[model samples]
Target: MPSSVPKTLTDWWCDASTEYAFLGFSYEVTACQSRDQLHREFADIRQNFNSRYVRLYGFCDRKGFYDDIVDAAWANTLGVHALIWFGFDGDDLWKGRRDVLLGALHSNPRAKFVTRVLQFGSEPLYDNVLPHDQLTQQVIKAKANLSDLHIPVTVSELAYGFQERGGAQDLLDAIDSINIHMLPFFAQDASTSAQAWPLVQRDLQWFIDHGNGKKMYFDENGWPSVTSSSVQPNSPNAVADVPNEQGYFNLLDQHCTDLKNVVAGGVGWFAHIYSDNQEPGYGIYDSKGRLKITLAPRTSC
Candidate 1:
């Protein structure tokens, strides 16, 4: 058993050692999802995959949606990486979403314990949801507003968005650390995860070169299991199927150490999704919540 206990949210994040990579799944909590479903899913995540973290993607529109999520996560002994989602419109939408998240956080005392990180927006820069400077200001303000909770606040964006977008450095300097989304499936490279490993490494190197030495986390990374006509792969060489999805995790298990060594603070990532019920093709489980691919046993070296 561990002797040290984490008092603050940042402490919880820091508790994971640089020598080992922590595993997690990105789950979207929809208003229509039942409480029983949430409990069952989180239980399956903990009991089956032995994952300790969950990166949540959703807004607080319906009452008790977030509370149920936190409760279920706490019951399963999983840490929550909560996201405050932003739409394509502007600050009004952003603020409304922010306020809703703040309300949820303030109302639930357990939120401080269960939530390890509070991500401000997902892909705000890539989608041009807000001006870079304005987004930076909001992040700074959020960090200040939630300082009492002691949770690390950051924004999620594509890995290259930080380098391509103007004023990214200012935003980077404002946040606690960098949260990047890297999906090799979208690249014009080889098909299978084995073929995509080189591109993954190249993306990691890009971060190492330009990330300003901040602690980096891949908030989203996984291969899609299937694709529709509208969701075709960028490369004809690429394929979307269950075998490739399994190969991605297999590669992660085999090269987990190299992934950790990409930065000084060590890197952590969450599998793109938990179930296809949330998003088509990206899930380890199918839409019916049945396991489609057997996850490789997590290995350190």
Candidate 2:
């Protein structure tokens, strides 16, 4: 077994592998970043980060970029979970982009080997980028094309969206899982790190019960370390005094532990990110590809 894998869900290893099958990293590549750098980073993740999958954020626009990612994942034996953008900028190029992305996924020789799940969109309702009906149709259309591959297809939403009965319900029935962004600290009724688990668990149960038997998967979950100005401005959803380094460790450790016991159930769980960025703060590694305080002593097999 790879040394980067964790031994148990609660092990919190500095140098241990886990029995868990699908711990993933949310990845975002900036324009300035090079393909060579990505190749090295992908290798590093496979060797040191204890992750078997990656959650890519958009319906990739550049063929070269998409191909580079495929090469990287293939070289490191990492699964790729591609997130189809849901008219984020507008509907102008959405259809065309979807066609291009689907074509690539269908034809890429390496895709069938490394691609695990193809999500329709990420947090569409939270951003109000696309109507629920439209997103549902997009998922259905993709499901039709990719059904032969037999990968799970779903749309991501915030936990709160599942609490009510309406468009969110329509979506829950149309897709495979109750995939959501469950950031308790970012919830409207936020709590501190030590007291956050119950609140998070309550939301998870709400999704499991109300989501009409669909499996639950956290599309994004992590506590931010910097509440002040650095990288991306702290999200508006974040509570005041979000968490320092130690607080981040405490919250993530507890949440992930509970996730293994109360949720997942052999399904996947993706951390919000692999590394800190100039825009987003929820990264285990710093911009220099170094482990941050929260991920000190990370080791390879």
Candidate 3:
């Protein structure tokens, strides 16, 4: 299905399994109160998957900061690998909380540090700030902030997290130099939806043909929750669950297999574990985390 010819990297992807399982807490900020049991909970989540890779880094404060966020590392294996890119404000957040971000980055700048890096897949809340050269400059400067550092970036290639609407060419041109984890999260309606697979295929072909298809990833798709559709829309945010599970994963698996044939690296799962019945319901699992629900796409609900 994917037009990609077999290359060594693609070959590796075909054979390897980058399927990661996520383990998230209630998805909230934790002060880790004395005998608070957050650590105990974290341990349980980590051990639940046995595998070292983490697809879900909890549901709250997707960004890596704050005292509780720092404690998240304890949940991660010292050498375990994972990704964390819930719309990070690299330019602004890095400025004030460089230490926090750097600490997060240091864990796995290289593949071993963190299998991949993530960019902002957060909603296009700030469409105005992305179109200008300023966005590129900020990203560049942010990368510069870690010149000697081994931290590599994982980009939500489809995500346009700026305050303005714009084209991918500029963003690609901007990130071309940075040797981060070159992966796209399938967010851009263009990137994720099966209907847009044709365009994505074309884009991938262009990149591979032009030799500019740097490190790539299809990190998202299949979130059942509508944009901002949480468990309890009125309450604080919680990792949401997808409504039509099978239907959602059908597209997800198809995208994974198709891209696996094209990209140099194996595909990374969008998430592993997330909260449910809280705020947004984009999770692969149900609220109890016990049921593996699958919903097949239908012509009509």
TM-score (all chains, Cα) for each model: 0.90, 0.79, 0.54
The list of candidate 1 runs beyond 4 A from truth reads 1-22, 88-91, 299-301
lDDT of 1 at 105: 78
Identify the candidate with maximal lDDT. Answer: 1
Per-residue lDDT tens digits for candidate 3, residues 70-174, read 344334442222322233343443233334455555453232223233343232223342444655564566556544443343334333332134344455565
After TM-score superposition, the amount by which residue 108's alpha carbon in candidate 2 deviates from its true location, in angstroms, is 0.6
What order do you get sorting by TM-score, best first? 1, 2, 3
Candidate 2 Cα misplacement greater than 4 A, ranges: 1-22, 30-33, 58-60, 163-167, 228-252, 255-257, 263-267, 296-301
For residues 146-165, write the lDDT of model 1, one tens digit per residue: 88887778998886676668
For model 3, the stretches where C-alpha displacement exceeds 4 angstroms are 1-100, 103-126, 157-168, 176-211, 225-243, 254-256, 277-279, 285-301
Q: Candidate 1 vs candidate 3: which has greater lDDT?
A: 1
* lDDT of each candidate versus the true structure: 0.77, 0.62, 0.37
Considering TM-score, which of the candidate structures 1 and 2 is the better prediction for this target?
Answer: 1
How would you encode candidate 2's per-residue C-alpha lDDT over 1-301 as one tens digit per residue?
2334333323222211231323666776544346787778778767776677777764446666667787788778787777676645656575676677678777776665566667766677766766677777878878889877555678767766544326476777778756667666665555455666676677777776667655566667666666545333223544433344346445545444445454335234566677777335677776776666544222111
Clashing pairs in 2: 5-17, 5-18, 6-17, 6-18, 7-17, 7-18, 231-278, 232-279
RMSD to native for every prediction? 2.9, 6.8, 10.2
